[model samples]
Target: MNLFELNQAYRELEERDDLDLETLKDTLDAIEGAREVKLDSLASWIEKNKMQIDWVTEKVKDLQAKKASLTNLNKSLQGYMTQSLDDAGIKELQTKNHILKPRNYKASVVVDSLDDLPEEFKQTKTEVTADKKELYKVLKDGQEVPGVHLKPNRGTVIK
Candidate 1:
């Protein structure tokens, strides 16, 4: 059934006193051919595995590039937001935060991008994304866009 069994059987037949030299030579050739086929199969399997590994490596590189791109974009956006928020009352529009009598409001730097959005923004996306209810736009009132909370609420007071 297996190579060893087949080899053992072949050997037993070859040791028969009447066995001819031609027959022995033919059997040895056949066994060598079988070994070649097995080796070819192993080579093919290694080639396929190598291809798979190469493909996965390229995929990992592409993902890393995408991550780097996003990081660069976030750094750019954050720097812009900080400068904009600082000069908002005179240059850019201002973000409005309201503290009801019992609550004191504080305005902190926040972003709603792919990576750095707050847990509150991620959880209540419907409230944050609606047109009139954005989470982080500078306002005119300083305009309060519904329920969005900004940090450092005490910017240049609106009069």
Candidate 2:
């Protein structure tokens, strides 16, 4: 049966707690059988798709490496072209297919030393975070910190 149907059956059985031992055993068996079938189907799907997934992963990695190489080559070529133009005492070059021009350098802040940083360029900001391990230690020591409390959590693990 499907997950929904299995859940509904389980809920019905839970609501009626006076079920006979034979009936309970049969219901347990059915649930186990359904779970086994679901597991098998999932395993089969993974087996079928694993090779294609690996291939796509490899392709993506290769493309990323190629893109990085191309980016580095482009940067080097651009630097060489700029140097050549500067050496030729030209600001712009025109060709049949392209025009090369140097863009103006942007202004940026450069700090020579932190101690020498201007007050006008400095700003203050506040950040807040909790240290869970420390907080747990304090709680375990029977001390309370304001605005901090622990709550019970629940989870399930399947094997």
Candidate 1 lDDT over residue span 49-70, tens digit each: 6788999999999999999999
Candidate 1 Cα errors over 4 Å, as ranges: 1-33, 89-159
Lowest-scoring 10 consecutive residues by lDDT in candidate 1?
95-104
lDDT of each: 0.59, 0.76
Q: Candidate 2, clashing residue pairs?
A: none
For candidate 2, write residues 66-159 as lDDT tens digits.
9999999999999899989999889989999999997668887788887788889888899998889999999878898999887878853332
- Runs in model 2 deviating more than 4 A are 1-34, 43-69, 130-159
